[model samples]
Target: MTVRTTDTPVRVMIVDDHEVVRRGIVTVIDASPALTVVGEASTVDEARRRLPAVRPDVLVVDLQLPDGTGIDVMTRARELSPEQRMLVLTSFDDDAALRESRAVGAAGMLLKSARSRDIVAAIEKIAEGQTVWPSRPAEDEEELSATDQRIVELIGDGCTNREIADELGIAEKTVKNRITAILHSLGLQRRTQVAAREAARRRAGWK
Candidate 1:
């Protein structure tokens, strides 16, 4: 549900590489009765520069970027003001990215496909110090075997199946088989989800 209140306008900074997405998020924030888009950036460097100047109450960041990942932004924001509330806005549902964002101290994580009202609600919830995530628990990372973990870790680093095989000195078919096993064990549907789940678990400080 959309949180509407003109009395407590929450200032927000938008950080995403996509112009269309940044514009869309701005539109959503502007339409909200209690939220305002104070500033925006397309890269971590740009975000770092604008962050202090804007000093927004909440920062909405995207995971994938041209120059660097959103974690860089989170790291910088934490350094500048650890108290600042950070909410990630990303199209990726990768488990590793989610975990990394949380590890870096994001207040919440919202899918980019979320409804406008949900997005607005997330902003308010973060502003009020509430953590927001998907209802279901992300898959566990510790279920995988040592080999499976290595395969997934390589995948998380953006390595292709062939590259993973070459690095592990295994056949391509073997690499694919290991990846399949990893996915099955973790109850994940995608490689990105495996990475994202691992990231979230790490962020949560689980073993």
Candidate 2:
């Protein structure tokens, strides 16, 4: 298990478009001894303006912002500070959004319906460099061949089919066929999902 090296509270920034929700989150964060709210924003524009200055240890963001999206904020945050940790706190349980968050390096995701304690714990875990995604059933887990695993890693590295093919010393058609098989094996429909899964695995320090 990962442990924090310091006793200081985890600094947090909230980006949600709802006033009531934001206030409630602020309350929950303030109630925690291990977490503190450094800033809050109700719009994407506001978040972008304040993010660099505040530089919170974790950013808890909602997906549907007035000006843009949580994805936009997370992407920009990554550009500004690659080490910035983020958590998605959204009402929408969207697979695409989740995959996008992982692709952009969010440490975790939580539904707005989650208990307050879960939210606090998620923030704490994210601050400690741990992932807190929703748990999948055992049946959803699947093992991949070594070649497929390498392809997943290449996809996570943003390699195109041709690039992966050349790097693996295989034909492009073979690469595509392998990716299709991988998608089916993983119960995923899109290449982005494969990439996102690989990214999350790496972030969690999985071999």
Give the best candidate by lDDT: 2
lDDT of model number 2: 0.85
The TM-score obtained by model 1 is 0.67
Each prediction's RMSD to truth: 10.2, 10.6
Alpha-carbon lDDT, every model: 0.80, 0.85
User: Candidate 1 residues 2-81, lDDT tens each?
Assistant: 23244778999999999998999999999988998999999989999998899888899997777777877877888898
lDDT (Cα, tens digit) per residue for candidate 2, span 1-207:
334689999999999989999999999999999999999999989999999899999999998887767877987898898988999999977555555577677888999999999999999989898999877666644666677779899999999999999999976855765676577667898999988898899999998
Count of clashes in candidate 2? 0
Residue 9 in candidate 2 has what lDDT?
95
What TM-score, over all chains together, does every model reach? Answer: 0.67, 0.67
Q: Considering only N, C-alpha and C atoms within 3 Å, which residue pairs clash in candidate 2?
A: none
Q: For candidate 2, give the lDDT of residue 97.
A: 56
Please report how far candidate 1 places residue 84 from its true position, in Å.
Answer: 1.2
